[model samples]
Target chain A: MATEIVFYDIPSSLPNKAWSPNTLKTRYALNYKGLAYKTVWVEYPDIESVCRQIGAAPTRNKPDGRPHFTLPMIHDPSTGATIADSAKIAAYVDATYPDRPSLMPAGTVGLHRAFEDAAHPLIGPIYPYCLPASHALLNPVSAAYFRRTREELWGKTLENLTPAGDADRVEWKKLEDGFGKMDEWIRASGEGSKYLMGDVLCYADMWMAAYLLWLKLVLPGRWGEIASWHGGRWGTLLQNLEKYETVL
Target chain B: MATEIVFYDIPSSLPNKAWSPNTLKTRYALNYKGLAYKTVWVEYPDIESVCRQIGAAPTRNKPDGRPHFTLPMIHDPSTGATIADSAKIAAYVDATYPDRPSLMPAGTVGLHRAFEDAAHPLIGPIYPYCLPASHALLNPVSAAYFRRTREELWGKTLENLTPAGDADRVEWKKLEDGFGKMDEWIRASGEGSKYLMGDVLCYADMWMAAYLLWLKLVLPGRWGEIASWHGGRWGTLLQNLEKYETVL
Candidate 1:
């Protein structure tokens, strides 16, 4: 029997940015493995209710309460297990359906480590750095809705969560500095390789693709030039999502 | 026959900080697998000789040469392949020697994902934020020595890498914010288990242990206290390292 999966989604928000990466990753893994599953996209503010159904959110009744109430929570009805954390969700989807082609390669620690290094930078400050700037441009109604949802999930105001005062300026500079580092890495990687892991499209490509998607939305001006350069390397990676969209 | 592995190291320096984590991880894997190899600790600022041998550094003849000139580059003499990047090195060690007790677990993706998430915040601004402050505190002679070694390896000054501008302050704030988020993760992860993976140790524990060691050295006072608190719970996860100290 096919496993049933529910993916809580927000209509239009940055936290949804976190989900998009894993949603695409999970969908890719499912399709690669040739497994079948269903997805449920919950609206913002109401995701709390969906989380309750899966027992992944903090609750007075449950013995242990999780720290935050973020979305991209996955509920496996078949096993009655609810998992949070995007990468964890991707791994769960891959492991539960092992008969399919493995998204993670066998006997390749270098591959796994590369994925870890690439994924970590995106998850830490990079995603958070992009959020406020992207959200600032939203219409007042959408912005208010976004802020309210963020507060509920993070248990703090978005302003407090962001790099404030001098810190904010420094983070922007660091982001700019990172572009040079990325450029250096691309040049060193050489032109012939199809993916970061050579020929096979691994998690590194998926992560870079997801970040590029968010970058495109949040920093369209910068991303437009980046997208055009290198003869559409970033564009090709973004379009690869078609392979994983079925799981979504 | 065991695979031949060579690690380039410096006795005392911060860039050498990269070596410790990679060494610790590879050492544990070697001990777990009962593999044997050679250990060579090169003097600081003198690794240029070693880099020249491996074709990793720049010389007058080749100013912009090789992928990276960073310390702790590994040469797999047997395979005639050279690999850098600490995480990638660890993975290669594990994959090349399959008979070892797996640093990662089978049938679990949550464990692997948790390890990646936990390790990411450490390497980003968290560790880099401490550099300038440490450099400022050191005496001129010592600071000069430290800066020289950095320039030799990275081909850039630390000041240029992390400027004293407003942008640097923002990076610090982002790191400080990360400390809070990590604390929350530690508190919330107390969900009826001691380790992140629960019941048994995994790669997450090893990665955290290695980071804790670096934190103790760089941000000694506060990070030491935090490390002790979490270290108490995860200490056993690292006990296996005692047998692998020779390689480290």
Candidate 2:
């Protein structure tokens, strides 16, 4: 039997639903490597129990002293290794499946990590713009859990976080500006590069592509507009990853 | 005779001086490639005149309508090409001398640019903390010009920019936090990696090493403190680049 990797993901109310940027990274890696993997759906509230059962580490400690667990964890039944955290899972998968197509090109792990680190702060301002739309897509149970937990974390209700009217435009402008900078950076790399890492897509591209997918999923209506904002560059890049789409 | 590249740099008063992170990237690239190059010192007031004489385009247009100019421009007498931006210069050099050690490996330019873009913002907050010390190390003419131009740009005097007191500590804390995040990202790349792109040093590493060198030139005392701040991992990385240090 082919080795099976059990991928964990958060499910939404919408049919054919799976959207969590972090977990999507692992999924993309698995798909890119052509590894045989089966995804196990876990709700927002069950992340802790699911991760704990698989022996995955806590992402962080919560305010109430409980360990904050996150999804995108995976179990490699063949190796009996369960890895949590998207980056960790990526590194583990890449190292174990050396002969498979590489997610991180040789000698780029650190550089890629720095790139992700740099882009991470930009992701923060986008949350306010995305959270409300994302809330609507979550299952009733997941939506309630997501709303309450995120409200406590953000110190604002979802609706209040991204209120309609001029406020939404203002928040969206911030996200657009951030992505604009990214576009400029990509262009500055000169004519040869199509993806963030150039012609061939690497883990860094996966990081971005997965996030773009998540953005499209949660805010289906606004994505086409936002994707077209940077001269349709981001949307085009997302389309480039279509070949790697694996049936879940 | 082998073609010698003309490297332009900002002048300082201190002996054995070197500054300007952008140009430092070019210098590191040349050194890594073991290329023959001669330094052409340009003071703050003379950069525009020199670059214009060399036919290098202005970096950007200023708010007041004057063409904005910056350092690290290069003159390739052999090809009669004078590139203005450090990134462009690096690309030109890496391409012209294809067999030399690459500043950027093939198919990685766009990814590297994203990495550089991500780290660029962190460099901004450190300037306020370093500008005063940097001013002290500049030559008389350069120092006076630096002070006046920077004061105008910042809308505050250098003395006021880095005030001595608890306030400085607060500013420093912010810088440290930025670097701390970088350190975390580096550690996340797994065990085998050393430089930003893993064991092999690349353009991104040069970008950082050059900045660290500037920090040392501007604030010698703080460089050691800051280098050691992140458990000396940064210091070790800087040391790793020592062999690539070319004598100008």
Candidate 3:
């Protein structure tokens, strides 16, 4: 029997919200593997209880001494296996569905991890730049929850945290430079090498695609420019994966 | 008859010199692939002429209009083919000797290229810190050539180009932080993943191993601490590739 994978994600306030980058990574991986899976939408506040109710493994303890919870968790009904963490979930999908496409690829887990490690930092500094737009996308309750939690984490109000006017431009330039280097990397891999892993859609592509997708959803007006940067490399890479966009 | 690969390298003044990281990459690839290869040592001045005579393709011209010639070029006697550029040479090695061990894992050329692109920059800023020690190891003739060319390239004299005292320490911290991220990446890949590509060796491992080897070669007295950074992670990765250090 085909395993019915239950994918979990945080729902934004928007009527037809896209998956967060973290959730999109797992969702994309499942789609790439051609697995039969269904989404289980969870509100931001209920993530902990839902995950715990489903018996998902706790990631780590937070500062408050409570077990940390995260989205993009999965439950495989056939095996009765539950996996949390996007990376681990991808690994599980690869392992369980041996006949499906491998997300990490054979003997590339370290490089894949390193690639992710390297890419995340480059993309991280830009998150605060999108704060205003991101905050607007969240539902009222979730927005309040996000603000309270993020303010505590960032130690700044969202208004003060988000770069304003000219500062925002500088931040965008920094992000562009980071993405530009990655674009050059993709091009230099080999002649006509399109995807991050070269000519094939792999997990790394999904990671970047998810990030780009989030940008598209949160900062609609800015997406055009960001996509156009690097000779439309980022946009085309995302476009190429249209076939793999299964869950909304 | 097996093809004999002619490995090109810049000769240093030191008696027991190792190939530069650029050259070591290809050399390591040849060794890893178990290919039969012999070193062809060329002085800095003769690099252009030797490569041209061997029919290797020319790199782009420098701003000063001098045609750039680089090492780690290879001549395959059996095919009468000469290839320049370490990345290209590695790719050639993988293709020509398909039955042997692959330098880049299958379906990972782009990610491998990207990983390399990301890594090299992290290690690049450390080059200036090693300048004084590097110049000391070069032959007088090559040192003169290196100084003139690098000064023109860097717009600073070799002595002044090298980071001094406090600047050097800051550079070291930057390098450590870069490598620390990479170490976290390696650990996060899986529970027991040791090498850059996870457990098994690949081109990325060779790239890092080559860089670490260069630090050891150029700064003999100082390589100890740098290798021991990140809780001996760098040392462990280099040690893991002990079997692949064949071309020296």
Candidate 4:
């Protein structure tokens, strides 16, 4: 019998038990591949210790130059491998479980990576608006940890992280323009295109859908606005990937 | 006989008769597709006039808001279509021919565009060094025009556009790192991968090879130096696509 993969995720106080887009991407990948995985919930403060105990390497060095551990790691007993980072986890699952459908189609792993890199500008501008909202959703312990970490990065209070009032709209508009450019490129798929690669749902779609889901969870009103932009393309994307939104 | 596509190019006094990476990209598409085409060389000063005369739409507006005409345009008499811009031209050729090996394969056009967008930072950082070298290769009329125009954009003389000495090396290193990141992403292609789409050639590969070829043309010394970076990946890529480097 194949052992269940041990997936690690951060718990949000939200009833759905998911919030971080980073971990949501992995959850979607596991569910889409029909992999049996049991979630191990970790708190913001314990990420480094949990990752260290399990032997999953840190994803990157923090701004302070220390190894920075992150959630959305997986320990696959099937291969006795411990992988960290959503992207690496996706690749590992796809490569190990060849019988299942691949999130990255043949010869497209690089293109998928490129799409995600290009997508950073699309998703990044929305971060300031999302941070305060996201910090609000965390439990007390994580809320404090999240605020301190993020505030340190920006050198400001969480409340001041994003521009307020009309300025926020201008900032939000930048994201809209970014999405419009992305939509323009993807529309080269011609009409009725729902995903980046047209019909098949690749890792890039999972990455995108994960962020769309994050916005829906934390910033509902703004999420509603996003749905109207780009001809409801994003709304339709979330709808299509609804099956993989399973919280388990 | 089918009417030939009119390919617009900016000529360099270099023995090869091709210098601009932008134009080289379109030329690669024409050759790669085995399309019938003839070059209509447009000097730097003549670009806007030639584009206006042919009714090829201006690619974009200039800093002062006037329509900015740039090259690598194609006028297909067979279809009576005038396409401007390298990417759009590449798309038009692939879409119009229908019989040639597609530069963009099924379901990959959007991915190709995304890859190109992600590639800009990689290609852009190298431009400062290449500009003066490129101007040196242009004929006097084009050289004067190129200097005046680019100086207007940078508010600096052609010779002063790029950093010199140790500073230039530092600036050049930024490009090396950008290419390294791209190589890292594409290395997801796993072992023995030759192109962005693994074994098959795609527009992204052509897009990259065009710049690689451009660097080789104007900056032979630095080009030779680049061959050693990223395990000779750029060099090998150019070597693999050598067949399509033909000047027509």
lDDT of the candidates, in the order given: 0.54, 0.79, 0.79, 0.86
Interface RMSD for each of the candidates: 10.7, 2.3, 2.4, 1.1
Can you give the DockQ of every candidate in the order shown? 0.07, 0.60, 0.45, 0.78
TM-score (0 to 1) for chain A, all models? 0.66, 0.93, 0.93, 0.96
In CAPRI terms, model 1 is classed as incorrect
Candidate 1 vs 2: which has more DockQ: 2
DockQ of 2: 0.60
| Best of the two (3, 4) by TM-score | 4
Top model number, DockQ: 4
Looking only at chain B, model 3 earns a TM-score of: 0.93
Q: Candidate 3 regions off by >4 Å? A: A1-4, A36-38, A46-69, A75-82, A121-129, A148-180, A222-236, B1-3, B48-67, B77-82, B124-129, B147-180, B188-191, B222-248
lDDT of 2 by residue, A1-248 (tens): 65788889888765667677787788888888888888889889888888888898888889898888888888898999988888778788889999998788777776677777777776667677667877888878888999998999989888788756887677677777877777765776667457666667788778877878888888787788877877788888888887665646
**Per-residue CA lDDT of candidate 2, range B173-214, in tens?**
877787776676666666645766666678877887888888
Model 2 chain A scores worst on lDDT over the 10 consecutive residues at A184-193
lDDT of 4 by residue, A3-45 (tens): 8999999988899778999999999999999999888889899
How does model 4 score on DockQ?
0.78
**Which of the two, 1 or 3, has more DockQ?**
3
* Cα distance off (Å), candidate 4, residue B98: 4.0
Could you tell me how far off, in angstroms, the CA of residue A103 lies in candidate 2 after the best superposition? Answer: 1.4
Q: Residue pairs in steric clash, candidate 4?
A: none
The numbered model that scores best in TM-score is 4
If the candidates were sorted by their DockQ against the true structure, best first, what order would they fall in? 4, 2, 3, 1
Reference-based TM-score of each model: 0.53, 0.92, 0.81, 0.95
Give the alpha carbon lDDT tens digit for every residue of B75-176 in model 1: 777777676555455556656755776566442232244345445754577444455445554445546766775566666667666635797678756654
